[model samples]
Target: MYLGRKAIPLISALALSASAFAAQAETDLKFALDWRYEGPAAGFLLAEDMGFFAEEGLNVTIDTGTGSVNTIPRVASGLYDMGFGDMNSLIKFLDADPAQPVTGVAMVYDKPTFAIVGRKSLGITEDPKSVEGKTLGAPPPDGAFAQWPIFQEVAGIDTSTVTVESIGFPVREPMLANGDVDGVFGFAFSVILNLKAQGTPEEDIVNILMADHGLELYGNAILANETFAAENPEAVTGFLRAVIKGFAAAIEDPAAGAAAVVARDATLDPAVEEERLQMAIDMNINTPWAQENGMGGIDAARLDASFEALKAPMGLTGAVGPADVFDSSFLPAAEERMLP
Candidate 1:
């Protein structure tokens, strides 16, 4: 059965039609990240670039977000199908309005990154109490600053003499570096590395991680609109499956992950981004608990304790519970989510 010229063109047409139909069959998902296309976002970006999402029958469109807390309303308002956001903020959001259609589906940062980054030259140190009587810069919408009340209460830091200046995000690090402020509230990875980039000596920097102190709150997570999730449960599961692969790839080769990020934004320094990526992996992503229990799920007992801790500072109405904010049904098997 030798193919003739006429049959060749007809076969090509059929192949093209089949390709178009397959593309149309995929589910379109809009995902919003908590921040810019930085080193931390490598997993998501790499998943898209490596065709992991496509393999999962998903057409994912990821956009950089303004703030972690701000991502809550974006998903709840049906503006996006899913988002990466702070879990503590999500808990507060759900507590305020139990009717919101968004909740966290997968835990990304098992240990919160919230921290008070200070400079030793400016009279700050590793002790949580060292912040007493010092000027601290806090961005109005920062996720870390939102947890200050909790940190203060848990760490028993005397804030009576501490000065908090409401500053913008762009100036938070600059003020700290210039000695205008003693410390700034931000993610440990972001602030510590940014300070180094600004020529601040690494030896002079001190990071007071809230998690290392007494804050039991979880960090950023993958949030899904409940309506979208119920409508497309398979898509949600598939998305998580792909995301697990992405994270595993990132853990295995951080340089490749950094390259994925640099591919998106050419203005970013590759070496700096690589270091940032490694820090996130070491400090946030691949924690001992995550390594032991696998990723993308939470410990119920810890989450309950976190809810209790947040009750006073966040002024909870006792409306939302651990079950209300996190739904782990969409995650892959425990073995599948294991780190490399």
Candidate 2:
């Protein structure tokens, strides 16, 4: 009886210790986003506000980023544990330095938003061949600009004929609006909306989505530091789960998504951001493939073909395979990732 009584107390003490440990064991994760707190970024914030990350035992901090290309280096340098970045940019970074400790853990945009937007009033035509004499404004760090070589190859545009003008992201739309440049390259939703904000009429702006042209590139993805991913695999999986939940929530209620963004930065115009979020959902995030395969998943054969197409344009030194860039082991089941 004395032995039994002693064992019971020990067991009770062990349970208490386990509970205490679990309470203190939340994994702190710092996430870097590709741009400002725009409408598209609402999913991550919504996931945090909705307690999705918390449910996974993760304490996540989301920070706005400068650009997609910059996120690759930021994650590789361990400045952030995970980030929202472009898949094409990630591939280029890996080709440059295969030794970098970063890989995409989940697919975000099923349809890449990369596009060549121009003012039709300036005589820019939707036909890729029409870019011959026009000056195209492109930012060095823009994902669409980074994919130009592939666009040039697919669209059959002669780089020699096109006047390529280097520009900054902040003033890209302004330049196009004022006729300073004939065309600009960026995400279609971003460029289109910004141009409208600058008083450019919706009909005058021409949006040419790259996916519709010839480039079969995947868009932004959730990237994780390889070392951190290897060390805390469950945390990586948990993070993906949270992100999937966030995307699902955003898909269900765009207003809620914009609210999540406003919750982070009150200075933003909620109406505009709400429309932006909806456009991102309609144009980039939600696609036929996403509807069929569910979110956070990729078609392996398509991904392989995409890498092959990017090789010549990107001028990859050594061979960097698609497997090296994307690791899908962390994604949740398709049913769990499906949009509502």
Candidate 3:
């Protein structure tokens, strides 16, 4: 059926309007993750796969990062609009140069995943003191290593007593497993599972979470460039809202979350990634504080205490408060952030 001359122009107008609507419906946003596609990263993919980001009018591109420490500079330099990175690193970065325009908008890991994993045969234990005089393998760019100074301050352990061996992330676990290093500093879930996969018995490895050992630091958080946030506040809010929904859904069904991760990188072992997702939830995301206060919101007192605890150890040039490090104004309503 051919349209009349007048009708043809009306149809063309409608088509143009539809195209414009589609173009205006989504905002393109680039997101950087603290690490590669792994168990914890499944939530972001699930959000994208489930259309949560699309529903929020966001076109997000999630990319892998070198480490939590590197994530801060990437976002601060405007290389990415937003990212997931270590909050402690962000604080130190800001302390050194308060001019940097970056802040954490959402706290994902309620408890820091930082830990010191070692073999019991090497005389390492739950106590932080066991690491003294030991050759600890640590990746230079690792967030855990960046926070090791603060950990030493809180635990009263002398840094000079421990021999620091800089190792790359790939060989961190292998070195620990093969006895090349007495211990390694890393994320609790990542290092523990890697060691177990390398044929190390779970009973032989000692897992010491920095939080339990008196380091009251938060973990990887949703970071945003202050310029982008100030220019497009709605985009930041939408991004975080989608993220909360993604994590809540992932937390309810970790295997499903692992499926999302596997979809992004098919090479990842489904079983390993699934277990890794669950461990991250049980050990990091679902902390008592998050359970009581809901996810993504940081406790003010804890944040302040963390700033104080790490300030001296980090050697800041000036004073910086929690407000300087994190901005919670972009958070969704507490009720909307509750996890199932």
**Per-candidate TM-score against the hidden true structure:** 0.95, 0.92, 0.96
Best by lDDT: 1
Better of 1 and 3 by lDDT: 1
**What's model 2's TM-score?**
0.92
Q: List the residue pairs that clash in candidate 3.
A: none
What's the true lDDT of residue 131 in model 2?
78
Per-residue lDDT of model 3, residues 1-340, tens digit only: 9877989889999999999999887798999999989999988988899999999889999999899999999999999999999999998899888989999999999988999999999989889998988889999889888888888888888778899899999999999999999899898889999999888899999988888988878999999999999988999999898988898889988989999999889888889999999999988898888888888999899888887787688886556678999999999899888888
Which tens-of-lDDT digit does each residue in 239-334 have in candidate 1?
A: 998988898898898899999999989999988888998888998999999999888999999999989999998899999899999999999899
Better of 1 and 2 by TM-score: 1
For all candidates in order, the CA lDDT equals 0.92, 0.89, 0.91
What 10-residue stretch in candidate 3 is worst by lDDT?
A: 311-320
How do the candidates rank by TM-score, highest first? Answer: 3, 1, 2
Off by over 4 Å in 3: 1-5
In candidate 2 the C-alpha lDDT for residue 239 amounts to 89
TM-score of 1: 0.95
